[model samples]
Target: MSGTELTVTLSGATAADARAVVRVLEPAFGQAKEEPPTSEDVTVHTARFEHDPADRAAEPAAGGPGHLSGAVTVTVQGAPEAVSMARESLAHAFTAQDQGSVSGDQEQEWQLLLEP
Candidate 1:
């Protein structure tokens, strides 16, 4: 399907947060073309992971409300419909964990801020 392309970026994330984000995105993005087919419903146009290994050591251990000394930004771009689906999935994820996400829209780009 044809739709506006959009990017979602998550900032101030911990390794745990990163893992959570992937769990939510994987269903929307699906496996690489080389991989066997799975139960994904949407296909992502692009996905990128950003993080620094040096900062990993400094991050607080996963559990309870975590703190962020650094960030792991995961960006995903896809059609509007797919992006919307991803957003809903993401919302459910954070809500389930009692974590809150601050989102803003600017020039069709959506940014999500996560704690811990």
Candidate 2:
């Protein structure tokens, strides 16, 4: 992955719920490389996004609210700034509770519990 790339792993929810979270992030990070999940049975879904530096200067798009069938655990891993930006984007669109984080020399991983 690129230094400016973010990988979002969503679990503890259905595929639809995971896609809902992705929809909320699309405006902030541009389109994700993964397509929407095709099976409802899947409880985990992953999406990858490459951050555009210019996006940091622009106003974050006001994403509409998303629906979740149940609480979802979202983990965002990437460069520190990229992870922070994704956290902010998710906060704006969901009821997110911090679930701790871990950081390395060049990357950061943040986890959150999201609800409808």
Candidate 3:
């Protein structure tokens, strides 16, 4: 299977904010964790999920809140189906999460940003 990367960036973020986003994505992705070099300013998280090439409808599941001190960016690398699922999962996460905030066009990747 081919691999594609899905990146979600959160600006002015904190560790709690990163965890909140990960909590929403981990279940579906099979892997969700924050990257190292974390500081008071920024945090980077990555997720991984898989999907079948033949089965288009593969639905799987899976951020918010807190003022972003810097920004948190999440990148998920997986198949096409996985990417689609991650997007859908993120939408759900946005609603389900209290602190996670979404501004601007909610239909796109940069739509959501952690509050603080």
Q: Each candidate's lDDT (Cα)?
A: 0.40, 0.84, 0.46
TM-score of each: 0.42, 0.89, 0.48
Per-candidate clashes, comma-separated: 0, 0, 19
Clashing pairs in 1: none
Question: What is the total number of backbone clashes in candidate 3?
Answer: 19
User: Per TM-score, what order, best first?
Assistant: 2, 3, 1
Superposed model 3: Cα runs more than 4 Å off = 2-5, 33-38, 43-57, 62-80, 96-116
Where model 2 places Cα greater than 4 Å from the true spot, the runs are 1-3, 55-60
- Residue 88's lDDT within candidate 3 is 66
Query: Which residue segments of model 1 deviate by more than 4 Å?
Result: 1-8, 32-46, 49-76, 96-107
Q: Candidate 3 — what's its lDDT?
A: 0.46
Please write out the lDDT profile of model 3 over residues 1-116, one tens digit for every residue. 54344444444446556556655655555443334224556544433333344433356452333233444444433444455576567665553232332333222233343222
Please give the range of 10 consecutive residues that has the lowest summed lDDT in model 2.
53-62
Pitting candidate 1 against candidate 3, the one with the higher lDDT is 3
